[model samples]
Target: MQADVETPDYLRDAKAAGIGGDERWSIVDHVAANPRAGDLIVGSGGARKIRFAAPGRGKSGGYRVVTYYGEDDLPVFLLNVFKKGDRVNLSKAEINALREELSHLAREYRQGVMRYVKGR
Candidate 1:
């Protein structure tokens, strides 16, 4: 089954990164087609970064999509994105922060699902 998707505020506000409505949908479609397409960052709260070619740009000029798929049961969270040269690598400190936040996000999401299921 295709996993549900979630986009965090940072990514949603990346207008400077050139992410438009079409680009966003393209990303959603890409991940929905292949949820495991991205390479897992060794550490970053299970986050993965995937490359996406823009409409006229090739892979070299593509954008990087940072996402987190905690498990089979959880939705794929689109955490952030940036152009290829916008940033190089995430720092250890950033990853550590993600670890803490994503943990809480997962727990809350699970609880929300359970409540919905039970309420139904």
Candidate 2:
């Protein structure tokens, strides 16, 4: 099934990383086609990290995207993105914070969806 991709922070991060439109769409398409394409990030509350090749750069020098696929009911959330050289790994504190944030996001999203469905 085609997955829905929500870029909550991806646009800003991609712009900051100098990622162009084509590249951005490529990433979204790939993720939508295979939401579980990335590896699971330990202690990230189900967040996954996927590496994408930049236009001319190989995967080694590409961008790393942080995504969360909490469940099939929720859209795949593009939480963060950064160049490989910018950040290699998240610190313990960072991981904990991400876990909490993701939890909140998932809860909020579900509530919002439920409200919408009821209103409809």
lDDT (Cα, tens digit) per residue for candidate 2, span 7-83: 65777888999988888888888888888879888998999999988777798899999888887787888888999
Q: Give the Cα RMSD of candidate 2.
A: 1.5
lDDT tens per residue, model 1, 2-115: 574656554664576877888787788887767777888777767888988867888678788878777778777777777787675577897888888887988998998899
Q: What are the clash counts of all predictions, listed in order?
A: 0, 0
Which regions in candidate 2 have their CA more than 4 angstroms from the true location?
none
- For model 2, the local distance difference test gives 0.85
Worst 10 residues of 1 by lDDT: 4-13
**Whole-model Cα lDDT of every candidate shown, in order:** 0.77, 0.85
In candidate 2, what residue range of length 10 has the lowest lDDT sum? Answer: 1-10
RMSD of each: 2.0, 1.5
Deviation of model 2 at 77, angstroms: 0.5
